[model samples]
Target: MTPSATPEPSPAPVLVLMATLNGGPALQEQLDSLSSQQHTHWRLHVSDDGSTDGTLDTVAAFAKAQAAHGRDVAITSGPGRGFVANFLGLLAGVRDDPAFVALCDQDDVWLPDRLQRGVEALSKGPADQPGLYCSRSWVVDQDLQNPRISAAFPRPATFGNALVQNIAPGNTILLNAAAAQLARAAVSAAQAVPGLPAHDWWLYQLVTGAGGLVIWDPEPTLRYRQHRSNQIGANKGFGATTRRFSAMLAGRSRSWTDANLAALRGAAHLLSPESATLLEAFDRARRGTLWVRLTAPSKLGIYRNGTLAQAALLLSLALRRL
Candidate 1:
């Protein structure tokens, strides 16, 4: 008798954490794109932050359809804090599940190979070590037309760069199992602070500060939708960039830095020795005199994205702004 062929072992499952808030306009398209991912072994866990629109219903219907097709899907109410808290809650919900995690936005259209590329990139690294994978994205209008590639950062990503600028966009991020665990451990620390500038930035800080490996993919993987009602739009043009610089001068960036430092200090036990030292020096420089602030960033290796950005940082220091 002919022997029956043995079934192939299934790929490791991935958990996608999507946070939604009034996403009715283009939520279905994003869901459809996710359903089309080449990496099929992914479960989508969506958390809605009290949407007054039909966002939750749309997600619920999508989950039902996916479940009927034998795919794992779930929906839940968010913490009502904000997007950052909503994402943190979802991360906490899957703490011990031992699955790869990807952060998803309700308004972005992921490419067919988004999950596949992330898995392939992460699989090359040491599985036992914490690792984060992030990539560039294509900025598009609401209709997903007129695509423009986001600006590339010439310098390598480091905790130094992460201190002031977040090069990694949340929509294009994927974390290995180890990295996700580290992030979960910091959720309480995040809640201890009054506010977080951005969840992705906090993850970048936590992962890098804990001596984890961070990979930056040069290729674009998703459509970052720009709309009038977006909480944070595709910050691409000169006007947006100038406004960001102005915020630094207006002490908003300094306030964000203070908040991040407080959160990190609360979780000091989790950081690597080197990272702890660096964080301390950064805080000291923030409160130092004009000359100290001017020279301390360079001495401490704290830098921004580009040369112009670095110059602006120095200017902010001289003016006692950052």
Candidate 2:
């Protein structure tokens, strides 16, 4: 008689954190995509920021359906501050849990292998060391059609690069146990700071600053839907470039940089000594004279993604706008 085949081991659990604020229009599609993930070992925790719409109803129905499959979904009332605060609060709530954490946007459609790819990439690294995996996305219109790949950043992901630019899109970020722990430890400090620019940018800085491993996969993992109501849309093409430059010229970059630096300083103890020193140097460079500002990028070894962006950064420094 033939012996029964061995059962496959269950995959590691991942805690997916999603922050929502009136995301009803496309929430169902996003939930369906999450249910379709190839790696089924995931639990979802959504923090709603006072949604007056049917977002909670959609989540409840999804939760009821998923419960039958042995998957769990939890909902919580957010801080009601904003998306940044809502995400930070979610991170704080899961600070003690050892499962891998993934940030999800309310409107995007994740591919089936999204969790599998991120989990596999992060699994190869040392368990004690922080590991963050982020991937490119296929930019799609509101209806998920007219797909085009997001711009690729070939530069190395480091603390220095994260100080000036954010390449890791939040929707695609996956943090291993160690990295999630680090983020949880620092969430309180981050929440104390007002107007923290973006949680994804802060995670990019925090992971790299703690000397963590960052894997930037070039393959597209999800459909990044661009619509009129998106909090942050796709940043590609000449029109977007022009808008970015214009924003910088209008001193928006400086404001964002200020907020980021303040938030980072509040969590300075969580960063490595080397990263702390680099952060201080960059902070000082921003406060220096015109000549110092002009030479700061090369001296501090901070950079953006492409040559055009790098040039624009230099110009912003020269104009005292960054």
Candidate 3:
């Protein structure tokens, strides 16, 4: 008699994670956008950091209202877990029960196919070497219209293209189960290291470090709404000389030279030598005159040509500080 073949493992549903704050006005817009996705296998896991403005209660009420209709929705909260920690906290929520995790911001509105397109890309890759993928997004005003994003960066983002600048936002990201499992470790590494920015950057590094792909989807899946309350809004000025001067005077900065150097050095262990070399250049960039730093022995010419990741990062860092 012929022996029965072993069955392949089944795929888990996608989990959408959103970290909320005083997101009273825009929270529903985002949630409504998510609920609009044709892909219904996904679940929304929102972590309300801390909001005196009824943010948690609003989310709770909405989830309950949605659940009465049999929607797979839930609201969870932790102490003021900080923005970065709130994103990481979801990993703990799903660590024992892993799923394809998508990072959702409290404000942005996703298009109908956001999660569907991401899942198609991720589901095709080898599960053992899972990854995170982000799509390009339209930078819009608080009204989510006019072309703020196009005016700000006005360039397509590729893994290599973003080497000097990161145009991807958390709301547009989709991290696989493997990456979710590695989130805590990645955070710990960042804490132990120095210059790493936040959960998003660390997740990118850790997943890509293990030979996993950090795919870039060029489609604009999000209406990236810009407002004052955002932690890191879409930066319009290109290292604007006036803004730079103002930034310097205002003492707004993301990293000192030493801390950035350490973070880059730490990432070396998480990426290929070629990628590591690039990260080193970015790390040294915070030191000033990256051209000069690139000439140093320890510094590698990561942005040899038209690498844009550094500029994107600078914009985000500057925007965050501002």
Candidate 4:
């Protein structure tokens, strides 16, 4: 008799970290989407920030249903400070786990292949080196209609670009084991600093600063739903452009820069030597005179995405607003 074939082993599980606050009915669709991922070996941990809109009940129901399917779903009380803290706290709790980590949004509808694609892409990199996988998303209206793709970055993802702008959206980010460990180690310092930018932005900076690999997949991986309750909306279209430019002029971008620099400084020991030097240069450039500001971008290789964005960055430096 012929010998029986060996069974294929299942893929390594992914830890899906979601932060929620008053998610209401929208959270249900997001939960359903998570249940339908092509990569079935995922465990979800939701951090709810004192939701009074039945969000906890919704999570409980989803958790009970998923449990029956042999999937592990857990919930924890969030820090109640805000979404940023809640996410960082969730990431901090990921101590020593070997699974890849995916940051999820409470309102976005993920495509079925989201986890599968991320896992496949991250698996190609060296196991010891940190790898961050991020992709474009189809920005849809509240009902998931009127789809529009997010912007594409023409240049490479580097620490320089990350210092001033974030190309990696949080909802679509997946970190391999190495990157997850790095992030887990850095969260305490990040959490200690107040007013830090979004968790995704900090991750981009932290990974690139540490000389890790950043994989930018051109494919759209999820439906980024835009609604009145979105903390951060899609970064596309003239309206979005105008809003960003206005924010830069209003010194809001400057505040974010300050916060990011402070947090990066708190974790300076983890940065690569070259990245450390660049960070110092960028910090000086932000505070130097007009000529230094004008020359900083070319010298430090600091950049944003497109021509228009580069122009805005220059203008912000000139105006001392960024």
Expressed as tens digits, the lDDT of each residue in 1-322 for candidate 2 is 9999999887999999999999977899999999999999999999999999999999999999999999999999999998999999999999456559999999999999999999999999999999999999999999999999998999999998999989999999999999999998888888888778899999999999999999999999999999989878787998789878888888888998988888888889989999999999998898899989988999989999998989988898888888
- Among all windows of 10 consecutive residues in model 4, the one with the lowest summed lDDT is 90-99
The sequence of per-residue lDDT tens digits that candidate 1 reaches over residues 178-292 is 9998888877888778877788888888888888888889899999998887777665678677888888878888888888888888888989999999999988887898888
Across residues 1-322, which tens digit of lDDT does each residue of candidate 3 receive? 9999999654457888888888877888988898888666777778777788978877887788778656667677754747866776666577544468888898888889888888888888888675788877888788877864433334433233334334446778887777776664445445554334556655654565446667778777889887778776554456443554464345444443244335445545655566666555554444555445434322433221123435533444344331
Candidate 2, position 52, lDDT: 98
The candidate that achieves the highest lDDT relative to the unseen native structure: 4
- Which stretches of model 3 miss by more than 4 angstroms? 1-12, 69-72, 79-81, 147-164, 191-196, 236-292, 296-301, 304-322
Count of clashing residue pairs in every prediction = 0, 0, 11, 0
Query: Which of the two, 1 or 3, has more lDDT?
Result: 1
* 2 against 3, candidate with superior lDDT: 2
lDDT of 4 at 306: 91
TM-score of 4: 0.98
lDDT of 4: 0.93
Give me candidate 1's TM-score against the actual structure.
0.95
lDDT values for all models:
0.86, 0.92, 0.63, 0.93
Model 1: how far is 292 from its true place, Å? Answer: 1.5
Q: Rank the candidates by TM-score, best first.
A: 4, 2, 1, 3
- Candidate 3 C-alpha error for residue 68, in Å: 3.9
